[model samples]
Target: MKKQELIHLHGLLAEVCNHYEELSGATVAHEEYSELGIRPTSIHKSKTDHKAAVFALADGITNEMTEETKEPVSAAAD
Candidate 1:
């Protein structure tokens, strides 16, 4: 994906984190992401930096979700 597209994805993921926090009333454990010190609006940063931030942010969000979702779901499709 182009840098612009990567940046867009970064922004989208950030928004998802925010929305999830608001809905669940629990902050995501984004220590890794925070340590990176990058933001979606940091357009001056390189694409690689944004990419790393995206991954870290995604990991944080998924970690939170995984902790909350302990039940296994059926794999059979309807």
Candidate 2:
């Protein structure tokens, strides 16, 4: 993806993290992403930096969700 597209995706994921936290009253621990100091608006940063931030952010969000969902539902439908 182009740099602009990647940045856009990063912004969207950030929004998701924020929304999830607000709705769940829980925090998404994105320490890796925070350490990178690369916000979606950080256009000055390199594409690589934004890419890494996106991965870290996504991983954090998914990890939190996985912890919350311990039981798996059956795939069968009645």
Candidate 3:
């Protein structure tokens, strides 16, 4: 896939991750921990990991794009 596509995916992933994180935090602030439904801690951990991975991938893609698009420096500018 192209860098632009990867960048788009990365942004979408980040947005999802952010939403999950916010939900997790909000859940934890409540005074009740009902024994029904999914656990907030687990969701938080999962979202944190996913966000980190997405950032790493985005960084790698950025590096690759830069390397592939480097321009030669003009000696006259030196």
The local lDDT score (0 to 100) that residue 1 gets in candidate 3 is: 52
**Which residue runs does candidate 1 get wrong by more than 4 Å?**
none
lDDT of 3 by residue, 9-60 (tens): 5566446545644764531221121222223233433444444455554454
Compose the digit string of candidate 2's lDDT tens values, residues 1-78.
Answer: 999999999999999999999999999989999999999999989999999999999999999998888798689997
Q: Candidates sorted by TM-score, descending order?
A: 1, 2, 3
Cα lDDT tens digits, model 1, 14-63, are 99999999999989999999999999999999999999999999999999
Candidates 2 and 3 compared: the better one by TM-score is 2
Worst 10 residues of 3 by lDDT: 27-36
- Reference-based lDDT, each prediction: 0.95, 0.95, 0.44
TM-score of each: 0.92, 0.91, 0.35
Q: Clashing residue pairs, candidate 2?
A: none
Candidate 2 regions exceeding 4 Å error are 73-78
RMSD of each: 1.1, 1.8, 16.1
lDDT of candidate 3 at residue 31, scale 0 to 100: 17
